[model samples]
Target: MTATASRHRLTTAKAMVDGIAAEMERDESVIVLGEDVGAYGGIFSSSTGLLDRFGATRVIDTPISETAFIGLGIGAAVEGLRPIVELMFVDFFGVCMDQIYNHMAKISYESGGNVKVPMVLTTAVGGGYSDGAQHSQCLWGTFAHLPGMKVVVPSNPYDAKGLMISAIRDDSPVVYMFHKGVLGLPWMAKNPRSVDEVPDEPFTVPIGKARVARAGSDVTVVTVSLSVHHALDVADRLATEGVDVEVLDLRSLVPLDREAILTSVAKTGRLVVVDEDYLSYGLSGEVVATVTDVDPGLLRAKVARVAVPDVPIPYAHALEYAVLPRPERIEAAIRAVVGA
Candidate 1:
């Protein structure tokens, strides 16, 4: 909450916690509750040091029943309390479907905009380090498809912190999904973009805006979460070989930035969507539809989609890498689209 010239940097997980801590300090109504979030911090270290600062009452940890805890958060929100509830892993969303999709999300609409559900449902998403099908899944489209909740997926620490603050301040319910790889966890595979300088003061990144991480004119690669880093890496690598690949990070999903995708696709005239989510009926397809539905003539050549096939994520490293939309696959898609 204080301003200083000294730059403070943090991993995506820590930066997220920092934003929550700042909001808690600013408003007494804001509180956090999730499994292992208090004494143990978060499984991904998203709530590190919160317990020491806020203590158990405000940063309480609940039992493993996600449905009960999430329902409790909804009740708190209805009573004018801003609650940040963690769902641990996105794959576990199945257990709390009625609470999430029916209640937490639709309360505002069902109440004719009179009731505000100011709650943040945060969860870890994406797959890469052999977490398998159950634990590893980027269900971006799953939450985005449902109306009522604003879905945001941050690819870096700065966005992570800013988005957390914004989600907390938002009057409606929000689904905040962070990728394990981008959390900068010690055990997960290293991601250079995961850690970055976040401001000491509180700030908010507009919920629906898309950031053009890499500017290019030859090809456009639109993605969200960890895939943004991969697209940027692919953009950098292909730049050396005369392939200009633009990378668009869809920081927020519920309000999909279709105009940004259209602008990039129109400028590049060749599109490649790299998504960690499934290849069908997800973010990738939605992006393609945005361009094609507007004007297919904008494309100079046929596009390529680099995304996980319709299959469960395998536990083995080799098999997992085979399905993940890695930098190599992104580079290949861009190269082929550019006819390089």
Candidate 2:
């Protein structure tokens, strides 16, 4: 596998494919198994050119049996193989979640550390382009709530590449959640951050760490995935009005970088959690608890949250936008938190 050009701009999909290809080249045991991953190059093009580069054997295209293919990946991982399995849509986890939660997640612990499941379950999430309730959902919270798997969501090309590399190497089950809105797909709405300069070398962004997308002292907004872009846009808009907003992009969820969350909240004294997942029993609530758990005295103003309400994502554009935590809703939440 050749290195990407230095500082060359790559879309999120390209970066992801490059990272997987690089790892597969370095480790023959690293194989990909999923629907349409071969000739189709993935529905969102995440596996574009992988078949040509690594051939059908390594990039195996399984039948439309999520349960069978996912179970096969888990067995392969236990036998000392690193498999990157694509689930197509995060919303479709119900089809094979038993394998994911019961076996893939707990096998290492159940085996008393004798076995390891070094597998990457890459899936697309979010609902902006009216894909309907069944086809679209940012179910990261559900995965994070589970005990054993690592949940990672990258907002940009750089982090996408780095996190994918890290997930491939990690000796545990990993849920790599990619929002279709950030995939830089020609058919979907585009965010500027989706396509950016990615380093040429095979680099790994430490999982369980958060990146401050924009530093500020006025208010802190903690978010992940596509919501990170919305927060950044709000941050920039607020900056011009003399209201500086700090944007924290949580690249991974299972590890839950509490220290980073506390550090930013302590500095700004105001916290606003923006999550694409549902509001109740999700990332938003966990973030609020993380801040208030240590000392409620740290908050200078009331904490606010921008998240999808406890409702299925609507298929209509207006209804879907209303449920999603878009930039307008995020900006309002920020203003409320900062009293700006």
Provide TM-scores for the models: 0.97, 0.98
lDDT of each: 0.91, 0.93
Q: Report the lDDT of model 2 for residue 79.
A: 88
lDDT of 1 by residue, 1-340 (tens): 4455555878899889989998999999999999999989999898999999999999999999999999999999999999999999999999998999999999999999999999999999988878889999998788999999999999999999899999999999999999999999988887788888988888899899999998999989898888898888778877888888888999999788899999999898999988898889888888888999999999999989998999999999999999999888888888888999
Question: What are the candidates' C-alpha RMSDs?
Answer: 1.6, 2.0
Candidate 2: give its CA RMSD in angstroms: 2.0
Q: How far out, in Å, is residue 221 in model 1?
A: 0.5
Candidate 2 — what's its lDDT? 0.93
Could you tally the backbone clashes for each prediction?
0, 0
